[model samples]
Target: MELPVVKYNRSHYIETDTGNKVSRKSVIYGSQNITLSGKTIIQAGCVIRGDLRRAGGGQTLVIAIGRYCLLGENSVIRPPHKTYKGVFSYYPMKIGDYVAIGENSIVEAANIGNHVQIGKNCIIGRFAIIKDGCRIEDHTVIAPNTVIPSFSVYSGSPGRLVGELPECAPEMYEARSKEFYSKFMAT
Candidate 1:
């Protein structure tokens, strides 16, 4: 069976054959350093900064997003930056499959694992590691260098582990992600 084509605002975006819907309003710099593994949706007003290379500066990849990932409108995905040896430098950002980032969020995380859900207006700090099947609540601020364990629910301003995910959470996320991908369309 053939897959359905995902339609979008053609004047403002382009939907690739691999199911990548990238809006023209979004700023994706250094496309060479950014890899989208297909079925990724980058919404309007989003900014993905792949221009920042590694600290050593040797043609390293900056942002690598896996399949069925969604970056919501007005959100910013940038590599984590730090001052090392009295010089400011940036590090790479890695995101796994079936991840969804909510609107207006700023993500500077080093790694985001599979089936992770980050809510609206959230702030994921520098070098933070989000493990698989984690759900981050809206307006939460994850501390820099923090590590989130798998199958956990995190919330609050400073971001605390409020609870653990249900046993069926992973399967649920997979279904939901696929459903969302299939339903995303302009008309």
Candidate 2:
């Protein structure tokens, strides 16, 4: 399938044949440590920090982003950090497919499952595990080490389970993501 393209000043962000559109303005560190499956979009001003390797690491992957994912503008995705046995260490971050992270959000999650939508200006704390088919409302603040069940909607300062997602959430999310990608082209 042919992915869409978005236009910028003179330089355009083209979706590659593999279905990835990475903005030139985005900051990606340790590219070797970050794996993008395919059909992923990293918007302008987004910062993905893969440079922070694991403690006692010998060439380990830090960040893994799945296919059909969209990271909004100015968002920050980084591995969660903690002190282990008196030594500060950074763990890996895993994000699943068809996930959309809204603008200006900070994600330090250990795992974000497929078909998840995280709204703008949110803060996902370290080691937080967000299951599949979940929706995180805008400006929500998820506490550290929190575990969110699948097929649910979360919101608020401490991120509570506000509602549950429909059984067809995965299909709906897939369609929405594809549609968004298709319309992300420059006029």
User: Candidate 2 lDDT, tens digit per residue, 1-187?
Assistant: 5445654452646556787988888999998999999989899999999999875747889999998899999999999999978989999999999999999999999999999999999999999999999999999999999999999899999899999989999999999888887767654
- Kindly report which residue pairs in candidate 1 clash with one another: none
User: Could you report the Cα RMSD, in angstroms, for every candidate shown?
Assistant: 3.4, 3.0
Clashes of each: 0, 1
Candidate 1: Cα lDDT at 143: 98
lDDT of 1 by residue, 18-86 (tens): 889899999999899999999998999999999988646467899999999999999999999999988
TM for every model, in the order presented, reads 0.92, 0.92
Please, what is the whole-model Cα lDDT of each candidate in the order they appear? 0.92, 0.91
